[model samples]
Target chain A: MADYYFKTRDLKVGYHGRALLENIRIDLEKGEILTLVGPNGAGKSTILKSITRQLEILGGRVAVGGKKLTELTYQELSRKMAVVLTDRVRPELMTGHDIVAAGRYPYTGRLGILSREDERKVEEAMELVNAGGLGKCLFTSLSDGQKQRLLLARAICQEPEILVLDEPTSFLDIRYKLELLDILRRMAKRQGITVVMSLHEIDLAGKISDKVLPVKAGCIYDYGTPEEILREDFIRELYGMDRGSFDPVFGSIELPRPGGEPETMVISACGRGIPVYRRLQKEGTPFIAGILYENDIDYQLARHLASRVIREKPFQEISVKVYEEAREAAFSCKKVYYTEIPWGTANARLRKLLEEVKGEAGIECTGLQEQLC
Target chain B: MTEYSFHYENVRRRGRYAFVFTVMILALLLMAVININTGPVKISLKEIAGILFAGQTDGTEYDIIWQIRMPRILMAAILGGALSLSGFLLQVFFHNPIAGPFILGISSGAKMVVALTMIFSLGSVGSMSSLAMIGAAFAGSLLSVGFVLLVSRRLHNMSALLVAGIMISYICSAVTEFVITFAEDSDIVNLHGWSQGSFSGMSFGNVRVCGVIIALAFLAAFLMSKPIGAYQLGEAYARSMGVNIRVFRVVLILLSSIFSACVTAFAGPISFVGIAVPQIVRLTLHTSRPLIVIPASFLGGAVFCMLSDLIARMAFAPLELSISTVTSVLGAPVVIWMLVHHCINS
Candidate 1:
């Protein structure tokens, strides 16, 4: 086994007698999918191309399997590596089978005539990507998602040790995006191929990646695990999205809206409220919760955990103990968000407190549209 | 027996029967006959075939069918097929629909060599035609390929590759102009007519040489079809599928250059056929699969060149027109019509 595996040392890529990217360094080990994440124009694709030797390296070096890439013959380099580009030229009439069969070219004759063994490899590759049924489908007719898979299948047929994908999931819809990554994850683990890719989906990257490289401003900040790299602070720094939230329930990181102000007061909802709570927790934003039945989800969730909440009957007025409890947490804050609650005469005292919030802090009172508040 | 049976079949996996390749061969056969039948001296089609098949000709029949029209007809077919196949290969390699052999300055490279030979009046008197063409085309085409290779050494972007080709073509064009401007009037006239292109003056000897060269190139291209298909998607994708792109591009340059340069040498620089035939074939087939496009364009070009030669010879009888003028005049209008139709239909 090669000890170094793969690494890029101070690599630069250029075109038209000009440099497109400069001073890049990257490394990968077996059983790791190192995803390069960056904003558009941050040279994410440039790094992949240089490493794969699709683009020439100007300043530094790329090594694969302990050999300098430039020193290797085209045959030697191809056996050690494969690549899936975001976009490329395709012949108008090629079928999916023909596309996949191309990957076996390095192993085939000078004329590119596929032997039976080559044909078998092609079949296996298409099967691995679940694109076998699309073998006869025209290249021009394939959906973007299908075409992306066909590209991957072609790479697989090469039987390379390192699989490099450039935004492999870009053309896929939500479900197919995950499906593609699932295939990559399996390829890395089962085949022991080192997988490298650039992806746009933050949460998906956080979930599946064994290594995360956050490329920002031409500098690579590598976080060794998903947990550390998926940090709210890290995302905010990269995307300038300070208000973004990694939703615990949906398992999604919602990017901060362009000009969204953080809530002055965060109201609590039960099951899906954990993400909002986690965001507030990270920022040290204070909050209050109430409508406590004995073992209620949010009220009990609030009491024993952190923050402050009022415990009382649903129809009851703002009783002294509960009022005192709520007032104590709110003493330092000006407003309360009474969210999605029914409005009625039974909640006369609660309305008074909400009315006072409007009077003192000019906060809009909510939950008045429903009957029981 | 086994090999023979297998060869008798289409040989492609999960595609149509081998009938397509066979039909294309048959089409080429019929076009070859038409090319041989029509020329300056009227020879009946049956008599022409009989003279060719029986291997005997009386003086008048021999001069008309065997000697006069035979070489020009064969030259048109060989050069036409060669140029078109070269275009098909190039368009696939570049992944640009409009890309052709001449786009990379192969013709200019050959032209430069031709110009050098013509200006200096260099070479043996008997072999001047052959030597000048072979020398000029080989020198110019190799130089252009070298330029493209050097650029590929530094840049990975295909668009950047395209830019390098266009720039080199410009440089070659500039040099050719300078060479022509300094030459004598008689040399200038021969060069101009040659550059305009024709097949009328080709002797049997020149035709035989061109046939051998085009055959070698076409065979080389035939073996390259699958890899070229992979290239159609992009170089990176082609590479991932085990293609050694540097090797492939070098071979492709040589193949396209051989075909294009031969046409320039024998028929002059018949520019538009190399660009247009493949595009037309692509539209007619409704697919750009090299397996089909390669042979289709070859046959199509043979027919096109023959037909164009006929029209040029007839349209102004007893007053010969340059072959390039006819192809361009016909080719440009058809291309414009096709583009408009493409825009309208699509």
Candidate 2:
């Protein structure tokens, strides 16, 4: 029974009898968060809609709690699954509390008057989402972040075994996006509820999801654990991004390197070169960086943005080969900017090298800030 | 913030509902008494009360009280409530506050069929039963609903849907006019007056039938408040919350049609009561919850229609105006104000 708490097989979905995606398969355990990530209009929403029964499935079946989704009565299905859609439901004259309480629909009596227990659950859900303070405010009057939280609160109050959302973070600010995902993580862990959602933030998706499904052109491209699927090549191919680069290790994105030959050499270490590298990238100046250890903090940016990087092994002294390369590169550049590089016994040679370059190259030392201004 | 305001809002909401209900009920009773006492041949309040409570005495006043004013007032109240409920349902269905039975051409559909039935039956049998007229009106209402459903499939715009509805209404009215011409010249005047809408000449039989049908519809609507409340969030969320959209939509359309059809069969195509009354009740109650709005709208509709009926009868003493004239004069401004407010807010 626990093998696949929610499963879909050979699923096909589309509008007006034409399939947009086909041959899809999903199998999930209880309490797992499965995230769908892809470029826009890649049928991510269509797949989510199909599994939640919002759109009719063109083929195949979804089974929840061992019952076929199509065969179960709506009431029975609702008790097991809940959804927060992207549709803007601007219900008039309803407070946030009223919107959340509407999630108790299946549990309430015929008239949908909430019981005392239902009220408690609603409060709990709001609290969990950090939306307890927003309960009395009108829904339409709330900010987009507040509305998204209230929607999550509403879905939480439903108390279903499975929850599905479509692009839940689209309208949220950075803080709210992180906070909402945090709440979802806690809910998934503590309540043992399975979550399926499409997210535009691949970095956050990779962080939160137990499994990641890549929605791509006309089909399910791949499905696996985030660690296996979130590679640099996969991210590049998945989005078909021509410009810019995605760093899988840091989950950071960098714009394509400036399109020109090397003009400047940046001398810095111990994370000091990051800002300088970014300024150079923005100024569209191709540059060379470092005789620093490979594991240095600045190495990450320099590796992506710099035309050439002079490197040494981590925790090792600057080698003769690296020093020769850095000195030559510095001389070949028009100007050189120096940033604070913390000196220690192992890497004291960098200061000597800098002094030698300044004398031979006839470049005067200037503060990095003065150079930027 | 959470602790203090939550309880305060609950109390405020409850208090507002209480206040609106009390005011509406009081107004309804006041208008009923006033309508009963003030007429072409005025009667004293004492005599009106006596006729209502005590057994009827065989006199003109007694006949006027029991036979004429009582049924007319009751019909206005019952059918008005029915119309408002129908409007509320249509607004919910279309997600537009201005949508109503008349605006959707549902009442015109019912009116057309009832007119045809009246002409054909009068020509062949010289008379038509009230039940037969209601049945014909209901059939016409469904026919218009079917066409609207077809239009809804093709056009998603609310105003476009209304344009289609208005076109359908004009076509139905034209056909009704054509049918009335086929009847004897004597019947043309009657048909024209009836089609213009009136609350006069309501019989006890019409009152009883509309009363039962409307009572049942009200009960059903009230019972379905849970789904209606969920539906206010829109179709996707409603379905996620266990509402079967296909079934719920059919039920909504059928109930709204029954309500408007009943009103049309009894009182011709009354305007704006369906759209205006529910909105007024919602604004007064300060909530859109179905449980509260449904009952309040019925009472609000009753009071509004009664007031309009009274004004229509007495505004030009012995020169009674059509009921639609009063309702439109009162209702159209509110609709316009709502449209402006809606535009600004959105």
Candidate 3:
């Protein structure tokens, strides 16, 4: 029981027990964050709703704190878990403070009047989400980000051991997205709350989730640690992405590279080549990038965007073999763009390669902005 | 800083409740006094106060006040309060402010059933029992509620639902008219005025029975304010907050039907008090919190109905209007205003 604080066995979930997704299993320890990432209509929200008891599970056994969810009454379940759903609520004449205070439903008396301690909890929850300033404003009048924070404050005030959210970051700008996920991460660590949520932003999911669940088709495509599950191939397969490539290390996705062969060459290092690659990709021109160490920041993106890549070992001197290959590729290209790749002693050979490429015909090396325009 | 603003809002909320409740209660008292004083006999205010407070009997005035005016005024207060509360419950259930027993055809259904029971009994036994009337009214309320629920399964739009309700109301009224047209002429003379709706001719027995039922139903509705408040956020959130949505919804419908049925059983069918009174109360209080709005709506309804009943009784002495006539004239404008205001804002 201590090994996994929350676990699901062969969970089957869907509307009307028709089983849109089946045979799902999850094992999560206390204080860990698990995220579901997938494309639209991929059953991510269904799984979250089923686990939180918002939707009835078609078939499964979910046990939280070693007690079966099916056996727990709503009152008991509410004390053990709280959920932030994606449904829009437009309650009339209610302030943000009143909305958050409603989270103490399980603890409040029959009339739901708040006690002194309950009020304190509401305040603390609002403060935790940085939404205390919005306490007096009508909920309907709040901006999208402020409303999301208020919702988080409400969930926090519930004081549950586990928190479940479905697309909590939807409709929020980047700042609010980061702020909301950061608050969730802090809650999980500081309060030992087990978090299970679905996010459309895969990059944020990969960054904050301790366990990543890839939901697609009709079942769990993959479920494991971020390092194991968030890979270039896995993301592409899971989302059926035909238009972009995902970078696992940076947790970012790039649109499909230009389709044709190399028409230009860019000599860059230490991430300077990334902007040039993006511009050329946007303009639909195929290009080559080279003379980059295997571990350089530019190589991370160039590997996906460049038609041809010349790479050498990391932390090693520029080898004559790779340098010759790069010089020949640069000479064959019609234009060469240089994007101020800083040179160091270990790669002193790049200067010689640049000088040699300058003597070639039909190939001109210039600054990236001037050459592109 | 947050604490300061929260406290400020709390103070403002309390102030609003105090002001609205005080104003409504005062209006209810004034209307009750005016209703008693301004009949055909024209009793003075001094006489009314004396008779009401000191139990002074002045023969004809005492007879009028004790036998007719007192019972009618109490019934107006009780049934009117019941109607408004029923409307508030229906609005919450349907998530539409325009939902009310009269507009939703619930009162018309009850009116039809009561009319049928009366005509059947008049032919057989020449009389109708109060219990039988109430029972028939309850059954009719449930029937109409059942129809609305059925139509609701196919129609999610609020205006479409109201249109269905209006159609149901027309059918019931038509059937009632058909029954009246075929009935004995003697019965039509008595049934005609009642069918049109009035607060006249109420006895102490009606005041007592309706008083008890409306009181109990109002108490039950008041107790349910917690769940009602949670439900205003919508069902999914309410369920997550530990409310049992299925049981809560059924109880809401049952309570609303009972309240409206009591009003129809006693007063035939009063229009617009259910929808207009609650909306006015909410607008005045500037809050939709069920805890505050339920009781405030009850008081507001009492004031609105008592005044409407007074106008129905004295606007053209010896040629009194139906209670619905006055209510429709006064309450329809408020309802229209709300609709226009809602459209503009939304």
User: Which ranges of candidate 1 are over 4 A from the true structure?
Assistant: A1-29, A57-70, A127-133, A218-223, A246-251, A255-269, A272-325, A328-373, B1-20, B39-50, B101-109, B123-129, B140-193, B285-287, B337-346
Residues B154-241, candidate 2: write the lDDT tens digits.
Answer: 9888788888889899999999989887888767777788898998888898888888888998999999999999999999999999
- Ordered by lDDT, highest first, the candidates read 2, 3, 1
Q: Model 3 over residues B1-346: C-alpha lDDT tens digits?
A: 6555886887888998998888888888888878887788988888887898998977888889999999999989888899999999999999998999999999999989888888876563137666677787888899899999999889998889999999999999999999999888877887787778888888898788888778888999999999999899888778888898989999999999998888887788889999999998887887888999999989988888898899888899889999999999999999999889778767
Deviating ranges (above 4 Å) for candidate 3: A1-3, A344-346, A368-373, B121-126
Give RMSD to native, each candidate: 7.2, 1.9, 2.1
Write down the worst ten-residue block by lDDT for model 1 chain A: A255-264
Every model's DockQ, to 2 decimals? 0.39, 0.76, 0.69
The best-first sequence of candidates by DockQ reads 2, 3, 1
TM-scores, in order shown? Answer: 0.77, 0.97, 0.96
Chain B TM-score for all candidates, comma-separated: 0.81, 0.97, 0.96
Off by over 4 Å in 2: A344-349, A361-373, B121-126
